[model samples]
Target: MSDAVQASGAPAPVGHYPHARRVGQLLFLSGIGPRDPASNAIVGNVHDADGHLISYDIDAQCRAVFANVRAVLQASGARWEDLVDVTVYLTDMARDFKAYNRVWAECFPDASRAPCRTTLGINALPTPIAIELKCVAEIKSPLPLAGEG
Candidate 1:
């Protein structure tokens, strides 16, 4: 049976789907954004009250995105070291990839231990956020028996 995973400390999903789903030894995370859990506000967006784009900071968004992913992983009994693969979507690759890369490097650190990633340039995202991350992670630790642990 598959288990839907939702972390209370992570940003609420914008859609009806759960933050992640676990089946067998793997956890599949849905599209995760750079929104703050407490405020439900998009991070790294610099827009006026009318929502006019002023400037954007991919770095800030990257941090929040990683944090959100981490929360989901933690809730699902996974960790960064258990990540197997990831696919990243960016609204503007030419303008934001550099900053996003820097933050990604900090998160993964050693290339040997990093998950395989695919970065794609997209036209738009759900909110004012410019980036979204989705991943699959392996559950390394033993899971509890249903209603037994």
Candidate 2:
């Protein structure tokens, strides 16, 4: 059976779905954006009081997205090292990929430790942010509080 994961410390999902789901040893995360958990605000974009888009910084968005993903993974009892695959969505690959890659490198550091990833250029996303990330991770057993035999 699969169990849904909703991280209380993360932003509430924009939709009805949980942030992640765990099935056996695998955990699947939903598309994670740069929304601040406390404010529900997009991290890298500036908007007017009327909610009109102004400008954005891709690097800042990338870092926030990664941080949000990390929070989801941890809530599911997984870590960055446990990630097996990741899918990245970008509204403007031509403009944002380089900076995003740099932040990604900082997170993984060792090339060998980095998870397999695919990045796609898209027309748009649910939010005004430039990037989002979703991933799958292998969950290690013997969880600290899962249960005791």
TM-score of each: 0.93, 0.93
Top candidate (lDDT)? 1
Candidate 1 residue pairs in clash (backbone atoms < 3 Å): none
Off by over 4 Å in 1: 144-149
RMSD of each: 1.8, 2.1
Q: Note the Cα lDDT for every prediction shown.
A: 0.91, 0.89
What's the lDDT of the predicted structure labeled candidate 1?
Answer: 0.91
Candidate 2 lDDT, 61-140, residue by residue in tens: 88888889888888888887999999999999998999999999989899898999999999999878899888999998
What's the true lDDT of residue 144 in model 1? 61
Model 1, position 67, has a per-residue lDDT of: 96
Candidate 1 lDDT over 46-147, as tens digits, reads 888997988878899999999999999988888889999999999999999999999999998899999999999999987788899989999988666667
Instruction: Show where candidate 2 strays beyond 4 Å.
Output: 143-149
Error of 2 at 104 (Å): 0.6
